[model samples]
Target: MALGWWGRQPVAVLATAVVVSAAPILSPAAGDRLIGDTLPVEAADALDVITPVPSSLGADPDRVALGRMLFSDTRLSRRGDRACISCHDIRSNGASAVARNLTTDGTPVPRNTPTAFNAALSFRLGWAGDIPTLHDQAELALTRPEFLGGSWPRILDTVHGDPVLAALFQAAYGHAADREAVIDAINSFERSLLTPDSRFDRWLRGDVHAITQAERAGYALFRGIGCAACHQGANVGGNLFEKVGIFVTIPNRSAEVLRVPSLRNVAVTAPYFDDGGVATLPEAVRLMARAQLGRELTASQTASIVAFLGTLTGSFEGRPLTASRASGTAQPGDTP
Candidate 1:
């Protein structure tokens, strides 16, 4: 246990932690420990690292369909080559998967583009926790010169020119191409981007076969070493701000603190962190362990934890959220 310096009662927490950290009691065919390790009710109640996705996020079909078109319409950009789809593409796990998204002119954006999947579940929006809602974030992104570089007039002009899109908006909101209706439609579509039914979630719901023994061990270690303090709640994070290097210094950005990201779909959202500085799961595991927890994990341990993270990959619209992992995903020890 990493409880020594953290003001925890070593003997008490460790004893219970041991039972909670152990492997299943028997073989799966025999149905013993079918749902894996059993923790004390108290211990279980104290943690919030895992939460099941809401079965229904309450999306309006009309708004979603209209938002789908708006999300892809490049005319929303000043350059006509960018749109909401440029960075937060639904086909790519709602992230562009780049170190930093760039403008049409190739200038770099300020920070990594977060995935839109499950974003509505987040308590606050943006890496800085600056934006309050998905609707507001969409508006800022649309108008910001650094992002979509669009104004209401320029975008409304484009929307008014498109008879099909204009009619769709009119039908959905009793009017054509207004700022409020536009953002509302986009927000509705984003609400439907929740990726549910991950293996971890299935395990949470009492399925024994959802994850492997090593993955379970990794989860135990994750709690034992205290990685879940900030990364808790339904989203698994996106609840608060966290310093990047609480235990160790990260050069160039050691002093900056930002909002913690939700790890629900982390296995597929590669090029991690605010700057997208890390590339592989294994590498990120090692660095975060050292920097955040003051722990140095072995490759075997890292692999196990990373394996647990893989079970976080969930499905969207009845398919894998991202197309990049269609062939296969990077294993624990594979190259980035």
Candidate 2:
């Protein structure tokens, strides 16, 4: 008797399911055990922050303006095709709708693009926790060969050649645009992407009518079942890193390492997880419950949590416009 297609598989799906279901509870180290120590209690106090939301960096008006332009500039990429918004779209919860977007040459990048909403609050940046600050992360992305694929000199040239960009940079930085100023401006704008006026935040701020009964119940279940341990901070999960399969490895290549993502605007950002394997919110909940909690969630529990997560969606104020090159548009030899 020959093995069928299903039988030829190395791991049984049901067995893998069992492992994911038992992993979270059985292994105490699966989630962020450092939640109590790392996330400051001050994060919960909305009034302390100047913007009424949790932020890890300071905001400067000029820097944010510069960042906004760079974020939308396609010239930042080596092939002049990709921008910060290419992967992390501000319209779609700050993440791309597809599993992954292509590089300038159309090569598929691995891993789902994480949301930029409230990303400044994360203790670490990127799916691997590789970059610590927004500025560093921006610089890495801009200079990475596989990513933007452009050198600093070329990027500076492209930006400086654009008139609209040059004017914007001048207004924002109070001088001619430079490489460091460009990076700082983008970082500042990113810092302003924090979203904290969700119904959950309102409820936490003593608004009894902010969230629905179902959402409230879901919040209780989230904490009661220990989901809150890692996903409790202002952004609701960006403050920590966690391995995907703790007690048992899920039958997937990308299961080993993952940064716990912020659940803010989770309703809009589908195809969950770093791999973008799970398609729906309910499936994401089920997968997370099984993988992180080691418990099978009831249908109602999943529904309520989904309802609560839906409240995290926020609105963006303005649309970024494409600007002209800064070089010929500005006065000669005006480089900062």
Candidate 3:
């Protein structure tokens, strides 16, 4: 019997059933052959595991606009120095380039900052999957001294003090600024940050030419080797909590159980894993295969998987997301 990624969760058994049952069967024999490295999967089968990102998650336009302004508003921070965009740069990959972000005193934070793009799609908030909602996450960030560090009274006063923000809040919420309304507006903007229409999504939607042969094969390997057990669904990995190093021991400083990250814009959001120790996409693929699946993949196999992951990069504002030129490519022999 195949145990799930999390020993107690039985995710593999249940998720595999969901995947198999959701797809329409054109030919039972054909589906068998598609699991290997040659043929493309039937579109019907692909939709069962990974669905396309919707253009919108139905956020109110006024809330989104107000939230967009607040996302960059430094007054949200106690020092009036940092903003949400300081770390989650919407202009780039929606994450910090460094392995971790610095606190007010310039000491590094414990974990790598995950991208803000498509974050609302995750079943839970934060790396540990502890926070229940986007509102809670925002509240934590606002109050945590090492993070935004603003007190509730001070934050409310700061917001009400600014004429522009006060007017925007009045227009959006029909009242003066409050903690809940501020967090709610920020959540609305974050929900609007979904990156959709990736090449892989197009392929899943029946555009055969959207992805290359190698990518299709890599996707086959991805599922065949059990990456999909934890990384399936519309956001491609955020729907479940799984422990790292299920097969091999990978070091982690935080809780062993982590919310699987979304692969929506993963190619561009480099410096991967919770620690951000892995530098390249290829390296991350190789490491995860050994750590999670107990498989030591060859260099070519890693490349194919990397190519497939590249297709997961999605568009924001009709423009394709990109990363730094020297983010580093996968080198052979790098393992967990």
Candidate 4:
């Protein structure tokens, strides 16, 4: 069976029959081929690609300072209402739990806001892998219709108009405010958001006492039941793309394919998956096991894995209350 993030399975033969009858002939046939294979050797190779977390690209003192300022700057938005940190909140786990954050006009966005914590480690950015790097993603977040809904030229104009911001831009990049420097500073700040001191990291570094016995058992079960087929490595996931349902049928939304998310700090970033359909962590665990593993897990097993996941949470390193140019009392979405 194809493994999922958690080890639950579709009901039983009855569930299998229902899936087979409803599924297109090709899907079940493909699933059977996948199941017959003995844990694709590529799975191990996938794990090998994961490397220890790296320092942020623009983590120098000046760049980080500029990026932090830009991150919370509300003027980057069209309505002067949303900042990058609005959705990618520094205090939270880099995301809000809501299905989507409201736009300046209160139009609900189409997808959940993904956490920015450890985003620099992602092989690809965004749920659909639409953007390529932190720089590109930051640009999209500023200009995407569903996001800040502004243009690059307007962004440059706003940054240059702010005397404090322009000075900071000069300090960070040795030039006055412009789009390139803005993205560089923002990306630099984002790069600094890495969190690697979790209990799992300690365990990897030979501190056996870092994690609990139950967590260790859950980690074992995670591999034993095939959850690691897609969720392996330092990030524990986000390295590869996988169909949502490998052994069973999954409800599809507009975009059918999704990149696996990193398990780091997953405990606080709730309402899981690309759609944010599943509300609780346990339900997500159960659903994943059923949909991917083609095997059922005991409640105890699910609880243990959840316990291990809790250990993934770590501290947010960015400063929350930094000065910005011409900022009054800032609301949730306001740009700097």
Best by lDDT: 3
lDDT of 1 at 327: 24
lDDT per residue (tens digit) for residues 231-272 in model 3? 766777776777877888876543388888888788888889
Which tens-of-lDDT digit does each residue in 1-336 have in candidate 1?
000121223244334434433322323343332221333223433453467877557888999889888877777887777677667767657776677877656787778878888888776788887887777888987888888788899888888888898889889988878889888888888887878898888888889789887777667656655566655555766766678788988756755678778887788888888888887879887888888777788877788678878888888878877634432122222211
Give, for candidate 3, the lowest lDDT window spanning 10 residues.
327-336
Per-residue lDDT of candidate 2, residues 1-336 (tens digit): 011122232234234333322322432233433211222222222211111244334588667767777877777778776677766666446766666656656776776777777777666777887776777888877988656777888888887899988888888778887878887887788887766566666666678798776665555555555566566445566555578876555656546665667677788777677777777999988777788767778787789778867766655553321111211121212211
lDDT per residue, candidate 4, 1-336, as tens digits? 011212232123223233322222223233332221232222322222223444344478788888888788777788877788777766656776576677667787777877877777666777876665677888888888778878888889888888888888887778887778887788777877877667766666668798876676665555546676666455667656667777777666432667777877777777788777887888888888988777666788789778877877666553321111122123654443
Candidate number that wins on TM-score, 1 or 2: 1
TM-score of 2: 0.75
lDDT score at residue 233, model 4, on the 0-100 scale:
52
TM-score of each: 0.82, 0.75, 0.85, 0.78
Model 4 residue 54 lDDT score: 40
Residue pairs in candidate 1 whose N, alpha carbon or C atoms collide under 3 angstroms: none
Give the poorly placed runs of model 1, Cα more than 4 Å off: 1-48, 323-336
Ranking of all candidate structures by their TM-score, best first: 3, 1, 4, 2
